[model samples]
Target: MLRPEIARSWWRSEMSGLSPEAPNLRVEPDAVDRRSRLAAAAEPVLAELAEQLGDDGFCVLFTDRESRIVDMPIGAGQLRDRLEGLGVVAGGVFLEETTGTNSIATAHELRRGVAVHGEEHYLEPFKRFSCYGHPIIHPVTRRLVGVLDITCDTGNDSPLLAPLIARAARDIEERLLQSTRRAEQRMLAAFQAAAAGRSRPVLVLGEGVVLANPSAVELLDPVDHIRLRELAVGIVHRGIGSPPPHTVRSVELASGREVSVRFQAVAPGAEGVLFEFDKPDGTGATARIVGSARRPGVRTTEPVPGMPVYVGGEPGTGRTRTVQSLVDGGRTRIVTLEASEVAVHGETAWLADLESTADDQPALLVVEDVQLLPDTCAVRLRRLIERPGLWIALTGAPLAELTGQGAALAAACPAHIDLPTLRERTEELPELVRAMLDSLGAGDRLRFTPAALAALAGHPWPGNLSELNAVVRAVAGHRSVGDITPWDLPEGYRISPRRRSMTPLERAEHDAIAAALRECGGNKLHAAKRLGISRTTLYNRMRTLQITT
Candidate 1:
């Protein structure tokens, strides 16, 4: 006769195909982000709890959202070693699916405090231990940050374990709230100091917070705020140590007025950037800051006198936009046609549209997704691209990867610019995230914590810029104002991959194989049988895919 929660956990464990006789206690080594806001908040609290628990056999364990042990501050040397042998040390995973029913996993699963003792454990290996666990939810986002657990031998189990774990969890949550409040306070103080006189337009920008002096508000519109923010974000990402000398940038506002902005950090250890704006003197040579246009890692092609241009990159790498930027007057000076329309509108209609657009205007003729063009249409298009006084540009896959007539069309364009994938441009993520927020109209109201930015950088953005933009838009819609923490990110984005990213089909196959291995307690032969693959094939796939059992 067990408690209802324990009975439910046992049922889930059985359904997970975990064996009561021999549990799968092996855990892989994971590199946790020590700079995480959650980790920062919980470390001190766990340390204090550890001293109180002492060498009295009780141990305190802190885990991240994924249930990987982040720290074990209280365990004795012998006990710590024993747990390490069972993969319970720092950086080791203790999820229910992998480790069977226990307090840490069960508390996370049930979203509450839980206690498990003696034979009540789902697996025999865990039967001699007693544990109390509680999930720590973010005070603002109300998302699970991690879990706190207290464990000891059953013989040394104390009635105080449950209460102690709950208190520690609450303490971590409170610290998280206080950390956000303190950051906002520091930003406000810095803003006040900078905006005291308001001689010129002054603005302080931080996560979920924006401050503007009266002069600033009067001189700027919503669009101006975004542009100024982009400039600040770019400067900050370049590296903000001791307050660097103010740098001036000429930026065009939405109202069509160009202003020179002075940018610097708000304060050391503060979470925002400070900006002051003034009209530029007509004589001073000013460098223009054009948001993502000036961002690093994105290659730009200069327009040749009469030669056509070719811009190539993966989808969402801003191919068409890059070409438009090269023309004298941006998109206004370009007549755009999508080669992909050849499939829907038929090649004849598509070709006719391209010819008419090229003949009708003196504008630059731009063909987008030219890789999708039919061979016949592509061949005809090459002639139009080669015509004198008709400047043309093509945006699509790299020239070397193109085939047949498409390759010929690209070869005719003498100027080529290749853009790198988003993953290769991780150093630009901070500025890119801010610029995107500005474009999405949330720049002034939202900012990411350094920890959150680090988490984002760790991901290998397989979907490139489009995926990143979608994730940012989704995260933006949820929080109106305040700094975004890593916990606030979507769960999938938060996952630190243990291996290289896989395609959807490969991921599904990988998941099936991993599940089978887990169900069979890491027995290769049995898992292979369950997955309907030979053991030799399983071994080869495991090696090729970098799956560790």
Candidate 2:
């Protein structure tokens, strides 16, 4: 009679579309994590096991959580060649779907120890050997870290094989436990050192752990704790080599009190960030506190009658709005002309319309994108500027950047207003975001958490107000109520704006995990499914990446 487990394994393999005649030996090069905690813990144990099995014509296979073989520590002579030929070598993926039923894939599928001998093997190519596999589980997380397998020639089966691999798996798990304990100890020690003398609210955050001084505990409410934890985790992941130094963010707590939190890593390899809180300066300014420099300012010269006024800024810097604000409310008649349309409508018609609008009545004429006008039109515009009853304003790039007709038109204007780029005006992010939300009619239903606003402040805002508006619109589309955290922002914005050291692979993995979480609305299980990794693997990666829920 077939064992119940083997029968189920065979059925699963068949359902996966694998043939019994041959096994798939394909490898996923990127699936293996050589530096994973599991691999590191298993190294010495596997080396010891390999020595004990020396010259025995036995092969030991170790695979990562993804079922890709990472090491073949004891594959000797002909056994190594046979395993390689069968796609059982290092880097090969041996999932049940790819290789049919075998000890390695079957143990991974069932999450238990399994043995397959001779004819019991699902594929014909594996009939010559007997194998036993045991899963290595993390002691702390109970996550399946990897599988340990040993294979020998048919009829050479010793009852000892199963127990031996089982023992090896336990040994690896123990080492993982020790590693976790050590990391926690290091993190705690650093936290203590930093918090020992500090009077202000201080806290250290790491994977699944948070340590806070009494001051922090008292100052922060429960909701504040969650947001602060998430913020620290994000920084740890974005930070390179050592913890980012002198990084500070101003955020409003759940209790409606705003504080500036200075962030610094506890120590290298500690995997925790220290939060030192302080009240804002006397002025209570909360934005752009990360750097020390003069704040950006908008400059404007009073508009003079009979002489055109020029408004200059980047595409999204509110140039047109600024120009419109100059007119007396509702009473002043306004006429507009777009110089960019001259090409499509013909310069004569455009110039004729400008002349007609100026002569029609006493009104303000606004010319947009004036840089697109021809030199002849500039002469016409200059002549129009002299009209006694007509007031004209030209809006386009800054005065210094304009040339030719645009330059002449801008210089002819007696008064000028120069708008600053969004990056230069980050101090206004909070009010700007609030005003935008109000415009979207979401102000009463949704609001950004302080950490979210801080993240926005760090961005360079290359697109100015327009890009910020688009982002707000996109976010409002998905959520209608409650606080919007940094986790809810799009992937690109979630990254720390400060530059730090990170390997390419690390950065890619970080981005992928962050994006998945955002798409799933912070659902870890769903995110893991979207990423094609098990929940346990996802948690491990999150901890490694310093990502928190």
Candidate 3:
């Protein structure tokens, strides 16, 4: 009998225009470079299990949530010519629509273990294979990380496969929990050493972690924390052996207190970097290693009293934080506008609210993602820019992109501040990492070891600070008790093929179009409709991409 979950997934696939016409499997070679948390957590468990299973012509596969195989399978005979020929290999998408009512896709969708045997598959070609799948969910977050599968040829299918797969998934989950517990213990131990004295603030550093003392936490704002962590993570990324060009940093907190700090890999009984702070009373200090890029747009000598300030940068490069830093909290109230968000009431109606700000009030109009604003919103913003009494601070992509949209936007704000990408001034990463750790809720407890820096620095940081922050948070969650090492880092980061090389959206579009054509018998018109695009657009795309079909 077909399970309800299986039946529904099959029905949904058919409804979505999936065909059993053997769509050339969407194989993402890029995934090969990605580090799979599931694979790592499942490894030791599977290795021991594989030994016990004893080469029973069965294979175990691990995949990301999307069902793209992530690792080499365990068990099974060495020869995999039959599986490879059927596109049942690493990087291939074995979703129900592509390969039919299979265990991997069904389990991924349902977030449970499922068994699909032989003739139950919707695709005829897949009927020769039997697969049982279990969803691997993160133990702490209870998030569905990926799917694990046990597959065999029809004659090798056994009733015991489901239970075995379930056991493996459980073991992975337990391992995840154990690692988290270990991280907490290690973090607390390091944090205590760093926070011994309340006289100065110190960032508790560990392998792949940057944590803050309560004093340090109070001293820096959220944005400062971000910058600090970026620097720390940068050090980790650059490798422990690579020291910063210089160590001392003299920074004025938003509170107007100027403090001198020393950044160096302090020699200790244990491993961790420490940022020891001191009063800048001419007693102890060194020239801070400043970033190379000048803040041409930001007025550092004096605050911009009333004039409009324009800030621009790529996503996750800290444009918002930069703009927020410029705000004079004592004088003006910060009113943020997400210009990119199209409200249900429409942009025109949304713009009308900006007019509500009277000239009498001292309000700073802050706009985020200005590059994504509609032309109508741009016109409205232009009108606001002309208001003499109105003070505005806006963030965008680049000056060129802003000007390309229209001159009104380009002319309104003449001074543009472009934030530096991570690749440009990587030397500042250690400091940034310090700030980032301080900003995170759990960061006060965690620290990064010297060796851990290499693991964090592996990627080119195409996503900039945004990606770095996420990776730091994830690594903190994944690591067990210890001074972090390269092994503690995500495998994806370690063997990264360079994610900055391609966008996921572009990859998804290319895969979808190619799959649509295969499913629709290479008919342009049919494929276009299936892809929800017009035939002319489809033809143009095909020609542009040099797709023969």
TM-score of each: 0.57, 0.47, 0.45
Candidate 2: residue pairs that collide: none
* Residue range 1-549, candidate 2, lDDT tens digits: 668888887876665446799875567676566666677789999899988887887999899987889988787789889878899876887877668789999999889999998888889999899999998887875668789999988867888999999999999999988887877787788778777776778877655466878888777654455466656654443445665665888877654468888876665434567778883343663433322122224577767555589988888888877777777664777788898888889989998898788878756789998988888887898888877777888999977788988888888888988887776665466667778999999999998765577667555566899999988988899999998877788866774422222355876787789789889776665787899997657756765666644
Determine which window of 10 residues in candidate 2 has minimal summed lDDT.
Answer: 287-296
Model 3 ranges off by over 4 Å: 15-17, 33-37, 96-100, 189-211, 215-549
lDDT of each: 0.74, 0.76, 0.64
**Candidate 3: C-alpha lDDT:** 0.64
Model 3 residue 240 CA deviation in Å:
11
TM-score of 3: 0.45
Model 1 CA lDDT for position 422: 79
Tens digits of per-residue lDDT, candidate 1, 1-549, equal 988888988876665546688655435454564656677898899888877877787778888887778877778777677676677877776766557789989988888999999888887877888999999997865768798998888998888888988998999999989987887787788778877865777887765567888877766654344445656653433343565556888776543457878877655534567787773344453434322353456555555645798888888877866776776665356678888788899988898888788888656788998889878888888888878888888899866688877678778888877777776665467668888999989999998764576567656566788889998998998988888877789886764322333565765677688788889887776787898887657755765555654
lDDT of 1 at 66: 71
**lDDT tens string, model 3, 371-489?**
66778777778777878788887787756555644445655775566676664544344455656766775456666543355344434567988988887777667753445555566
